[model samples]
Target: MLDLHTHVVPAGIPFAASLAADDPRWARLERGTTTGDVLVAGKVFRTVPRVAWDLHHRRESVEAEGGTGQLLSAMPELLASWAPARQGLDFARAFNDWLADELPGHDGFFTGLGVVPLADPEAAAAELGQIAAAGLSGVELPANPPTAPLHAPEWSGFLDEAERLGLLVFLHAVGSPAAQWFPQPMAANGVLFPNSIGEGVAGLIATGALARRPRLRILASHGGGSLPAQLARLDFLRDITPPLQELMPEPATVSARRVWFDPLLFDTGLLSHLVTTVGADRIVLGTDYPFMPVDPVAVLDDPALPAGLADAVRHTNPGALIATLRSHVQQRS
Candidate 1:
């Protein structure tokens, strides 16, 4: 089994200390003397786990779970894309360096998806080349960054650079002000943050981004969020609305199928809908490992999926993505 969506916090990096005194968007980690949990911006964020830093522990855990490989990206809070361009660049470089050091000599059990400082396009593009050179397959970009959404005009350069480098751009949702309008904490945090991926997809289709960057590889996490559920509505609006028709000449589903999605949706019913609408070949197995604790293998093996589709989601679809990842890992090995 291959788990595509796992995260790691680099050991010995004082992520919060890198920020200036006036920087308030992110909190520095304050390790507890007695407790395993680390406080971030005065709130208890998470208990630091050895698997988050220890390769031996992580490898043993994955082996026990029958996982052959795992892709490592930075934990979302560490992204700090909202910070100043200079700071963002520094953090990104440090993170990517740590990834390069940890990943290059290791066996094929681990592959890394590096990070970019989206606030600075030139720096981001430059770093993309460095990351590719470091033997990472791709970069994990925030779907709704503090500066702009994934498909906004400002992001075209970054997207172009990614395509040029043949990097798989994984769009993971990070919290934003717009997504917080739901008012209720649970609703905003749980429902809004995850489904914001839908907004990113809609923006991509409406802005003709997918059409423009045909070679860009985008893999959406959380079963493409609500895009699978909203496919028919987008198609209907595109057909009837003159403005949308011009922007989206083809059906939304058609453009959507061109991208890949992780089957991390909690609901099997929603996963079924995604498989049917997005095509099984475009669906890949992702567990959101250590965060969601859902088994990708069990989700794929559900009796609800067609037999062929079960195999495709479990292996073939992910193999398409992994094939690209393997090139980087093997190059370094």
Candidate 2:
């Protein structure tokens, strides 16, 4: 199995220490050691360790699960929270450099998903360029900006460049800040645990960003964040909106077909629904390993899953996606 959603923390990237100093958002919050201790949507939930960074520790987990390849992403929300564009860009470059050195030469067991300075698009474009040059498989961006929606005009250029370079754009939920912005009670009631994930998908659909970058491959994490449920509503909106009609022949067509969904979902029913809604070919296996006790095979083995779809989710989908970006790097080289 090729685990698509594994996370890694590079050796040089300060873990808790950096969060305490540089990241005010998480620093102020009361953090817990285990997944249950961490608060999301005003409820305490356990937080899983990011295992991909620790090669030795993860080897057993990977081997135990019959995993042959692991795609590593930077610790969640690491680059997204940097306030300044320059600082975010610098942090992204440093993180990618560390990952490049650490991931390669591991018997081809590991590949990296580069992080971009989404706080600054120019910086993001530059980082994307560097990632393409380095021949990394893809780049990761927060599903929603730590502070804003990613489909805003500021992010368009970065998406454009990613499309031009043939980089796979992976977006994962980093939680929402509505609770932080409003009073605790109001925030608690109004904020959804994984609502940001849905917002990120909606933002992309509304902004016509996907339409603008047709060739760019986008992977949305957490079952595309409630997208499967709202397909009809988005489709109705598309019929009424001129911009969407002009950009896409069908309203939710771009999102339904163009964007891919990952299988990090803990609920078997949800995973099955996503496969049925998005089509198995568009779904890929994402364990969100280390942070979650995910058994890739168990997810694949779910009785509801189609026969051959398991192999595609586990290996073929990710391999094909990675091959596209790697080909670009080879051509450049």
Candidate 3:
């Protein structure tokens, strides 16, 4: 299986630590006597097995389940975009370096996405070249960032730069403040992570940001989150709302077709509905490796999926990111 949506926390933190009494901020992995814990802001983030960083163990675990290879991402907590701009950018660059060193894995089987510091939009935009030069294919972006809204002018450079570099973008849910506006700053996801991807991606489309980044290949993680279910309502509103009608060149459903999604919604019926909405060709496979207990492949390979479509997602549809990684590795060889 070419499991694309997997994560890892390096067993070490090469950077210095900030252990303050009143203010604590840092992201690292602490290896316990037996297991390891991912720590963000000096708090225990996730207690993970060696599979989180042990390359041999990770490969063995996947092979035992008949998986051929896995793409890797740094754990979300490591993104640390909530930190100050320079601090966040430092973490992202360091993490990208660490992740790139692990790639072309054990004979070209492993590839991964680097993380960026959205708090510093310009720096994040500038780091894409370093990420690519380091042998990474793309970067994972937080769906909602504490900076200016993704559709704001500041973010256009970043999005356009990613497109120009042919970088793949995977937007993962991260509940965040809608913007830096204080006193009455709105929260993007009132319920935190659950509603983030939907509101974030939908806002981009409604505000015409996605349209601006016409060539940027973005994947809406977690089955486009809640966006897929709200397409009909958005389309209806667009048809009636004069401003939205003028802003959106296409209906919300058609606009959504430009984005890619994975079938990790955790429901068979919902998966079928996603296929009906987005078409099978736009779907990709992701197992979220070392996190889920059961075989994540079972979701994509479920008998309930349309005939032969599941096979297409598994064998043929590795998506732009993996395909780019393959080309990068080939060039190096």
True-vs-predicted CA distance for residue 325, candidate 2, Å: 3.0
* Regions of candidate 2 where Cα sits further than 4 Å from its true position: 15-52, 146-148, 179-193, 241-244, 294-299
lDDT of each: 0.75, 0.68, 0.74
For every model in order, what is the number of clashing pairs?
A: 0, 6, 0
Better of 1 and 3 by TM-score: 1
Top candidate (lDDT): 1
TM-score of each: 0.89, 0.81, 0.87
TM-score of 2: 0.81
From the highest TM-score down, the ranking of the candidates is 1, 3, 2
Residue 169 CA displacement from its true place in model 1, Å: 0.6
Tell me how far the alpha carbon of residue 296 in candidate 2 is from the true structure, in angstroms, after superposition.
7.3
Score candidate 3 by TM-score against the native.
Answer: 0.87
lDDT by residue for model 2 (217-240), tens: 888877776776677777887778
Q: Top model by TM-score, which number?
A: 1
